[model samples]
Target: MYGRILKVYPGSLAEELELVPGDKLLEINGTRLRDIIDVSFAFADEEIEMLVEHEDGQQEVYEFDKDYDEELGVE
Candidate 1:
């Protein structure tokens, strides 16, 4: 599950999630993400796992657990 961060809205949902522009999404709950549709569907769950790649070539994994309908605060 991988997609590049195309854009981020100022003071929007994505900003609160720390999803910065130029970051590359690598996976969701250990599952590979193919596109925007996959990311939308995968984030529907209460718990999610993600892999993010920074422009410096550093990769980090994150786990987020929240209310099912909680907005991801993403762009």
Candidate 2:
């Protein structure tokens, strides 16, 4: 299962990663995502490995080391 991105906020990590609406979030930190709750838990970590499938069907992995409070900025 994948969580679809509806929006990527300006000045957010998601924006920096070039993620956009319609992109599908596949996994975080090597764990496949099933729902928003999983996403929330995954976001608690400072280090993240995210796999995203673009609207065009291209898959990309984005890794980041961030402050614990920093937000991914996607809804």
Candidate 3:
């Protein structure tokens, strides 16, 4: 499963994750992602892995390890 990002907050923690508007979310951890709710629950873990598609057609994988309940300020 996958979801496309429609918008992003400027200067938010999402920027630090290198997420941009229009990026295609491919996966979370090793599981397929479907929507925002899926993303929300998936990120509840202390560690996460994400596959993203860039506007220029580049695909990237990012991993994050943080405290539980920490918000990335993304939307």
Clash numbers, per candidate: 6, 0, 0
Best-fitting candidate, scored by TM-score:
2
**Residue 71 local lDDT, model 1:** 62
**Cα shift from native, residue 71, model 2 (Å):** 1.3
Error of 2 at 26 (Å): 0.3
* Candidate 1 lDDT score at position 63: 81
Q: Highest lDDT: which candidate?
A: 2
Question: Each prediction's TM-score against the native?
Answer: 0.78, 0.93, 0.81
lDDT of 1 by residue, 1-75 (tens): 468887877775457667888888888787788888888888888887878898889998878686777665554
TM-score of candidate 2 relative to the true fold: 0.93
| CA lDDT of each prediction against the hidden true structure | 0.78, 0.91, 0.79
Q: Please list all clashing residue pairs in model 3, or write none if there are none.
A: none
Q: For residues 1-75, what per-residue lDDT tens digits would candidate 3 score against the true structure?
A: 677877667776578887877888888787788777888888788887888888899999999897788765655
Q: How accurate is candidate 3 locally (lDDT)?
A: 0.79
TM-score of 1: 0.78
**C-alpha RMSD for every candidate:** 2.1, 0.8, 1.7
- Residue 25 C-alpha lDDT in model 1: 86
Worst 10 residues of 3 by lDDT: 5-14
Writing each residue's lDDT as its tens digit, candidate 2 over 23-62 gives 9999999889999999889988999998999989999999
- Kindly give the stretch of ten consecutive residues in candidate 2 with the minimal lDDT sum: 63-72
How many steric clashes does model 3 contain?
A: 0
Model 1: weakest 10-residue lDDT segment is 66-75
